[model samples]
Target: MKRAAKYIIGVMSGTSLDGIDIAYVKFNQTAANDFQILNAITIPYGKEWKSALKEGFHLSGEKLVKLDADYGIYLGKTILKFIKENNIEKVDLIASHGHTIFHNPTENYTFQIGNGPQITAITNIKTICNFRVQDVALGGQGAPLVPVGDELLFSEYDYCLNLGGFSNISFKENNQRIAFDICPVNIVLNHYVAALNLEYDNKGAMASEGNIEINLLNKLNSLSFYDEAKPKSLGYEFVSETIFPIIDKFNLSINDILRTFVEHIALQISKKIESNSEKTMLVTGGGAFNTFLMERLQSHTKTPLIIPDENIINFKEALVFALLGFLKDEGKINCLKSVTGASKDHSSGVVYEVESSKFPFSR
Candidate 1:
């Protein structure tokens, strides 16, 4: 018989390329949100893998297919190493939100590498992945999926905002969950910081030193995407085709660019944080550590912004993907209509499993 509680490993790779976030979680089947995070870690990508994934967008169709298979194998080996290092022995399932290579929901196509079958074949465990495709097929943004976890696992918060590569917010409005990307965050900031040979703006110190360029700031704030209604999402293409070009036109110092962009981000996000009397915002992800950005964000709204612990800040998405897999395993809805603009609420993700004797993964 199947067990009520499950020990599962959830994996996620965000656009920031910060690394693969791995969370070993235990879910109590009898009660929702009754879960324990036994262990968590981020496996930084080597330059080789990073370059392969980054340059993959321009690859030929044949090469892209090969890269997909290769990435699946890479993910499997990495996960095996994580298991061995953590001394985790009893994983009931694996949920992998493979790195998104392409996402254009308007055209109804979104792809994430790391094959589910390959993951199961290597690990010899049941696996669930490709969580976004089904939602896109049903006419949805196929993003901000973590809101399902927010609704069930973190209902106490008035708003759940994640500041990853991009800033996205989720909250209950009229009893329906609504969420959308606010603006580009580290995806833009880190891009500029890399010019200085730095991984990030530690505590937003560099940005705090520069003066905001009003002209550039106004240009960023005037982007057409900001006025668009919800049920939308952003991709790396937006940054390349729209955001960077606008910023590059103004030949300003890197610090000035970061400073202006931070203001633009704060202003855009703050506009969404209605000056409520009792509501609070739970902020997480890498951007939460940027003190200067946080201060600017706090200046615009009366809502108390709560910064969670480092574990939650770094691994919350991985944790939520774990929750998504758990719900999918039980045949429950893991995608939301309001959040993803899907036709209807549905259980998303393809499940895979290979018998131990038939495992084809080579050692």
Candidate 2:
């Protein structure tokens, strides 16, 4: 008999501490490069959870472990609630791109908390998570893993750029997908904006008022990460260490800082897009909503930029993570060797199963 289609919930919490994006998808393997998104939803993080995750990188070993377990259980409960509300049935597994904590691949250590085992135990569902560790272990950046999804799901776009907590772009070069983090986005923007007791620069209004600090802009545009080659990724540590200090030196107002950083972001992103002029680029993620930033980028590049629906822009990463899980469950290569600079294309993520018979979780 033919196997039934698999229903999976893909969970993701990006570096911006935006919240967990859970996508409930029914995936069918029609062909190698064909798949569809059935249904999806983004769950906003509560204040307490957001605060805890924002400071997660500073926690100690034991506290971090506790947070991991607690967060996992929280995710499980959230998933169960989502399923009930949506009336979803026949879920095969939960694929989670847990919140990234420490991502220093040069040190040979990377951690994405939200314990998968705890998730399975609480939800009584099979879980697949920690998608970055193995790729890093094989001497890769352990990031920008969504390119495979971009490749398969939206292959028509010549370039796929996501402006989430960080700005990263992926595109075909000599028949290979090359992707890397361009610059910090909301992670840095939100940090400064939060100091003003605001959550974010809604619609980029605050950034639109202030003048760009030419000195700060020049200094930011000259950062070493910009000079680095492709297949590289960035983490929170880079911002805390390299970006924050420089921005802190100037005693500028919040709006000025926002303005300068927005320009810096536009400069970095446009430079990459200009490097190739042959095709249309699909841009998504939270930063895509930043009108000022988008305008700045448009000023610098000549290539046509296409912004999809709000759902696709917001949930693309989550949708891609769901695709990652589907590929992993089928023993297919999900991690792109070209994008991550891994030794080879590999299936990444650890599967955890709950020791329960009540929920009837099956593939």
Candidate 3:
């Protein structure tokens, strides 16, 4: 017999490479989609790990495979540490959104490192990971997977927008879920700010101080990605190839570049959330902490923005990934064809379970 209520650990390493987010979530099927975040923490990547991941994408296939396994062991060790430090022993599953290395759906391939077997072997917890590969296999973008959680867990709001490495929004459209990436956020901002030896612009202060380069902002806003239809996503490759070269050509001050790009991000996001009138947009992720960016976004639309507690703002993705795992465990449609343009709605994830595993919790 299977249990309805589960204690699961969700682990995520995003494109921003900020750190690994681990959330211990208790999902109760009181009626479906009811859950609580019991504990969550982000372990900032050390200098070595950060450097390795930053360069891992460019490695040869042979080297990339090795790096993938190594990263998996690293994630396993980190998850173990998180569980030990928090005294979390009872867990049904571990869902890891291993760091995304390459994501290009047009080529019909996407890869996220950190081996699932390595995680299960090291942590002794059943694991579900590599959630995107299946979606891509079905001729979809294999991204913006958070919408399934948004549809069930956060449907009260008109929009569920996450401003992480990239800005993505999910909402119900004509009784179907629709979601897609809007633009780059921390992925671009952090790249420029690294020149100043800062991890990020505190509350977008640096961007607030600088003047917007109108030319640059206009160019960025005019990028073809904004005009494309839904069921789309962005990756590090797009940024490194498309975004950086354009900005570098201008040779503007770092401050100006930051300010213009922030403006560009706000403009692009406003285009999506401000369309429907009087809607409540739930904003989360690192970008939500950027005061200047938030102010700019608010100014662009009359729609009210609802930002939850810091926990939700920071670790909501991890929490939602846990929900995705729960859906997969129940053999439900966790990845929507409508949201991802896949061939069909399907449960997307590879599960690894220990032999005759005893679930620590009793329902």
TM-score, model 2 to reference:
0.95
User: Model 1 misses residue 266 by how many Å?
Assistant: 0.7
lDDT of 3: 0.91
Per-residue alpha-carbon lDDT of model 2 for 123-162, expressed as tens digits? Answer: 7888999999999988888988999988888889988999
Q: Lowest-scoring 10 consecutive residues by lDDT in candidate 2?
A: 29-38
What tens-digit string does per-residue lDDT give for candidate 3 at 1-363?
A: 555679999888988889999999998788556788999999998989989999987997789999999999998899998889888879999999999989999999999999999999999889999999999999999999988888988889999999999999998889999999999999999999998888999999889889988888888888898999888999999899999999999999888888999999989999886555578999999999999999999888888889999988889899989988988998998999999999999999999987676777898
Candidate 1 stretches greater than 4 Å from native: 1-3, 356-363
Q: State the lDDT of candidate 1 residue by residue for 43-128, as single tens digits.
A: 98887888888887778688998888898888898888889998888998999999988889999999998878778888888999
User: lDDT of each model, Cα atoms only?
Assistant: 0.91, 0.87, 0.91
- Estimate candidate 1's alpha-carbon lDDT, on a 0 to 1 scale: 0.91
Q: What's the TM-score of each model vs. the native? A: 0.96, 0.95, 0.96
Off by over 4 Å in 2: 1-3, 32-34, 275-278, 356-363
Of 1 and 2, the candidate ranking higher by lDDT: 1
Instruction: Mark the 10 consecutive residues where model 1 has the least summed lDDT.
Output: 353-362
